[model samples]
Target: MKKQLSKIIKLILLTCLIFTSMITQPATADIASGAKIFEIHCAGCHENGGNIVRRGKTLKKKALKKYGMDSLEAISAIVTNGKNNMSAYKDRLTTEQIQDVSAYVLEQAEKDWR
Candidate 1:
């Protein structure tokens, strides 16, 4: 009886884990994918969401909001066109990649680049 109960508990835990993973997998995958994209392309200038060249235009929530760039579309436009010291990535990165990086930036901004 003890062995059966232990097995049942383990099975239930495993089932719960699988279900949780299924529910959260897409968001996790997007974040991980965006992290990779950011590392390859945006990390040099915006390391940890801090802009080296343009300090006032950092990727933080406050700076972004101040510059009217708080939304994903706004960020994507800036990334695509390149403003001020920032170079245009429209030719280099695909549309999907730009969108992914935008999502990643927004997520990091919300978390304050913890």
Candidate 2:
């Protein structure tokens, strides 16, 4: 019993240490990557940071109003499958890129919209 308890304590401590290190590192948000992808690709249709009146609806207010999802998941699905007049991006973007870009859109909306 003592040996088993000791091993469990050590495992917990090691796990905590690993988690602390990960948290301490300068972690970048996936949104940053998504923003880059959007700037390069989606910006053409949707416009960067803000939405376009000519082509598509603005993502800022409309997204929160229409979909109760987080900006990240919303953007990823839009990028992957598209909606309405928008074209799907599953063939063009990788899963990692989609997640990153989704995050990026939220960041952009935050920075540019408000």
In candidate 1, where is summed lDDT lowest over 10 consecutive residues? 24-33
The local distance difference test score of model 1 is 0.89
Winning candidate number (lDDT): 1
lDDT of each candidate versus the true structure = 0.89, 0.70
Model 1, 1-114: lDDT tens digits are 999999999999999999999985533226677889899999999999999997788999999899999988899899999988999999998887888889899999999999
On TM-score, the leading prediction is 1
- 26-109 per-residue lDDT for model 2 (tens digits): 335576666678778878766754456443356664564456544566767888998777788899988788777777777666
Q: Which runs in model 1 stand beyond 4 Å of their true positions?
A: 1-29
